[model samples]
Target: MSRIGKKPVELPKGVSASISGQTIEVKGPKGTRSFTAGDDVTITLEGTTVKVTPRGLSKRARQQWGMTRSMVSNLVVGVTEGFKKDLEIQGVGYRAAMAGNVLKLSLGYSHEVNFEVPKGVTVSSPKQTEIVVEGIDQQLVGQVAANIREWKRPEPYKGKGIRYKDEYIFRKEGKKK
Candidate 1:
């Protein structure tokens, strides 16, 4: 049995869920989101809670049981609290700024990198070195942050580049003269 699947997801205040066939839709103050589960699992909404169960004893069914439960939980949270990812730029003269729908990044490159902000997500630059990505979808928020960081990943030597705020870079000793 799956431990996570055994626990039903509770709907918070002002949040509602609807189930149709294999698809589940959740709506809250922030927004609305939907997820479709595999045939191996069944989804049900009980009053203010959501439950997920496996349809059989097969391995795939068991796997889907846990995954389906987690996906449902994410939908609830996403509609309620949403998701956020923060990135920090490090290095001399490296900075970030927002120009309308574009994110301007200076990562020691010869020219500034312009990143277009996609819909359903908001990108903000609170400071020259900080970037915040916010959205109702967790996957989209994370993917956008990763794409921005890809422009200049933190190096081990000088650690000069863009990285998540909480991320730690492993330092490497320089070669002897």
Candidate 2:
């Protein structure tokens, strides 16, 4: 059995949950979000809690049970408290800005990189070196952050690039005589 699957998800007060077919919808004071249940996973609502179970007795089904449960739980929490991702521009001249729905990035490249921000998600860089991505959908927020970081990943040598605020880049000494 899946230990995480056995843990029941407690619905916060004022938050509502509904499961329809393969989709689970969660609405709270903060916002509303929905995600599809895994193919081998089944969800049952019991009072204020939702129980996640597998549809079969196989190993794959067992593996999906806990993951589906955790994904649903995260969706609920995300819609309630929202999700946030912080990125830092490390290079001296590297920076990011927002214009309309586009993210303008200057990563010491010859040309600026223009990224279109998706709907339902917000991106802001209060400080020239720090970028913040926020949204009610946890997966999308994280994906956007990853995409932004990919534009200019931090180098191990000088540690000069875009990276997560809490991320660590192990640096190596340069060649010396």
For model 1, where is the 10-residue window of minimal lDDT?
A: 68-77
Q: After superposition, how far is residue 126 of candidate 2 from its true place, in Å?
A: 0.9
lDDT of 1 by residue, 51-169 (tens): 99999899999999999999999999899999999999999999999999999998887999999999999999999999999999999999999999999999999999999999999
- Candidate 2 residue-wise lDDT at 46: 88
Once fitted onto the true fold, the runs of candidate 2 whose alpha carbons sit more than 4 angstroms away are none
Each model's total of backbone clashes: 0, 0
Model 1, 13: alpha-carbon shift in Å? 0.9
Global local distance difference test of model 1 = 0.95
Q: How much lDDT does candidate 2 score?
A: 0.90
TM-score of each: 0.99, 0.93
RMSD to truth, every model: 0.6, 1.4
Alpha carbon lDDT of residue 26, candidate 1?
95
Model 1 residue 34 CA deviation (Å) reads: 0.2
